[model samples]
Target: MPSEAFDRFMGALRSAPCENPNRIGHAALRALQDSRIPEDALPCPELQREPCALNGVPCEWLRPPGAPLQRALLYIHGGGWSLGTLKTTRLFLAPMVRRIGLNTVSVGYRLMPEHPFPAGLDDCLAAYTALLEQGFAPRDLALMGESAGGNLVLALALRLKDEGLPPPGRLVAMSPVTYADTLEGSHTSLIPLEHILADDSFVVTKAARLYAPHTPPEHPYISPLYGALGGLPPLLITVGTDEILFDDALRFYQKARLSGVDATLLVGDHMVHSWPIFSERFPEAAQAVEQIAQFLQGRTP
Candidate 1:
């Protein structure tokens, strides 16, 4: 059973009218840009944030003073691959940045329905490589993201392996879109009841089509669950049982472990998609962030 707060959250979601699936991303970006939210807001005044470009890709760094300059966690924001921006991602990750106390770089990867497929991936890769060129060794770096961003974390790792680049020290994917086969034709038996109930399949399917257009849905870069998972970094994956991507996280963890990768899966019972990031609304969210902090520091959680 979930708490009263979880119940309230779910109730609100249920009562809220669903946005048009086709316009969700564009609408979100437009509304987000129109809002008055400050771009550099952090949890604490002591924390410093800098906007910079990595290999021509725009990025923001949220840093705790005196933290090692060599270690960084590259964060990718999620918005079904078409929404999300550096300002929004920075705000979303600010609390986590304070808790983790590590220098975190949030990538503002190019969005889709305009930029599309390899463009976002290319920007992420560029940011990562720029970090390497700046003297951060592969073993000291980590990659983290949620939802479509989570998908990118895995996709980027796969791309690195294919390019003969060293894998990062750690990876944390929260409710990633791993199996994109749902974008191919129809929703298959593999999709969970939770997803159907949430009506998230429509958004996911539409977003994927808009982003990948001509690419095969099963392409390892697009649907990482189909890719080989050997020789990657240690992984921590989290998903809510009630989310559409629950199976996505589970299947990926299973395959990764089967291939001898050290992987951990954290399932939030009765929680919705990306619930861990909603720290202020749920106790479960705070706990999840704590676990993430510990995991990133190589401490067993």
Candidate 2:
């Protein structure tokens, strides 16, 4: 059973207003942008912020007080491919920065229904490459993301491997959408149980189509679960028992381990998708963050 606070949070989210599934293109973009957290109201006053462009891609560096410059993390924000922004994701990113005590670079990648599949992936690749060029060696850097961002984290690693670039020291993915070709497996059963996601609707699938209409969903870059998983860095994946993507994480972990990669999967019983994002109000969120911190610490030199 989940705690009282977790239950309450889910209730609030269930009651929150959502955009109509029929809306697409500019209409969907407008609705998502309108619903975002205002820029001026973003939290995390303790960390010094530096907004800059990395190889032409916009990114922000959030440094906790007294954080070591030697260690760095590239954080990709999630929005199911078409939504989410730096201001909207700061609530989660800020706390992770403080907990991990590293110079965290949050990438503001181009969104879908506008920039599309390769565009967002390109921006993320550019950001990672810029980080490497800036002197953060493979052993001193890590990659982390949630949802669509998590997908990019994995896709980026595979791209890096193909390009002969060294992998990051560690990787963390939370509730990632590993398979995009179909809504099969645990997705079908878990969606109805998860309060944050819809089961009967086509909203998510529509958004995915808008993002990658030309690309095959099963393409390794688009759906990393179908990609090669060997020789990647140590990985830590977290997912809630109630999320539609639970099977995605589990399958990825199993494949990664079979391929001889160091992989750890942490499942939060009765928790919703991206539970770590609610760290401000939930104990489970903090516990997940701590687990990620420990995992990263163990892999760090």
Candidate 3:
């Protein structure tokens, strides 16, 4: 059973108006800075957050007190490719930093409707490349993200493979938008119950069109679910039973496994989308974060 706090949070989120992305993108950038949980609530007080640029793309580095010098994580924030920033996602990143004990780089990629398809991907690729050039070995690095960021992480892995670059050691995608072209999925039936994302206005369809107006929907870089999954590193995916993209994650896991990729999926019953974002408020969220930590630790050399 979900916690009372989780239930209440879901209720409040559902009641909140689903605003237009064009406006939300800018409004969120400002509001989230003030809305984030207090720093005191973060697990790692010794975590040092520094704003920096990677390959010219803005990013923030979170360094836990005892983090290994070589091991690091490239974190991508989710907002349908339009909204979200490091400040907005600090709560989610804090736990990973504390539990996984890795220096984390949260990418602030260019958003859509402004920069579009390859722009965000390019920024992510550049950040990863910069990390490599800085001497972080492929085995010491990992990729992680939620929702659209999840989509970007998976797509980034595939792109790196295609470019003949060294692949990351592991990946964690929470409720990834694996299939962006269509709303075809088992979880589509939960549309009426989904509190965070809607079936039609979701950035996957709306903002995505603006993001990749010219790119084919099934293009591997656009919807990695359509691409080859073989030879990719081990992956861990988590999704909520009630989220609209549950099946997107499920299908991606299935494809990866069928293609001989090591994949694991954790389903949260009666939970909302990206539940791990609320780690401080929900026990399940904390559990999810622990699972990610274990996965990363197991892969780390």
How big is the positional error of residue 99 in model 3, measured in Å on the Cα after superposition? Answer: 2.7
Off by more than 4 A, model 2: 17-36, 200-205, 299-301
Residue lDDT tens for model 3, 137-194: 9988999999899999999999999999999999999998887787666446778877
TM-score to true structure, per model = 0.90, 0.93, 0.90
RMSD of 3: 2.9
Q: Which stretches of model 3 miss by more than 4 angstroms?
A: 17-19, 22-45, 299-301
lDDT (Cα) of model 2: 0.83
lDDT of 1 by residue, 182-213 (tens): 63221333245353224553446556777899
Q: What C-alpha lDDT do the candidate models reach, one value each?
A: 0.82, 0.83, 0.83
Superior by TM-score: candidate 1 or candidate 2: 2
Q: What's the ranking of the predictions by lDDT, best on top?
A: 3, 2, 1
| Model 1 TM | 0.90
Per-residue CA lDDT of model 2 for 140-215, tens digit only, reads: 8999999888999999999999899888999999888888888788778776777665663334455578879998
Candidate 1 residue 90 C-alpha distance from true site, Å: 2.1
Positional deviation of 79 in candidate 1, in angstroms? Answer: 0.6
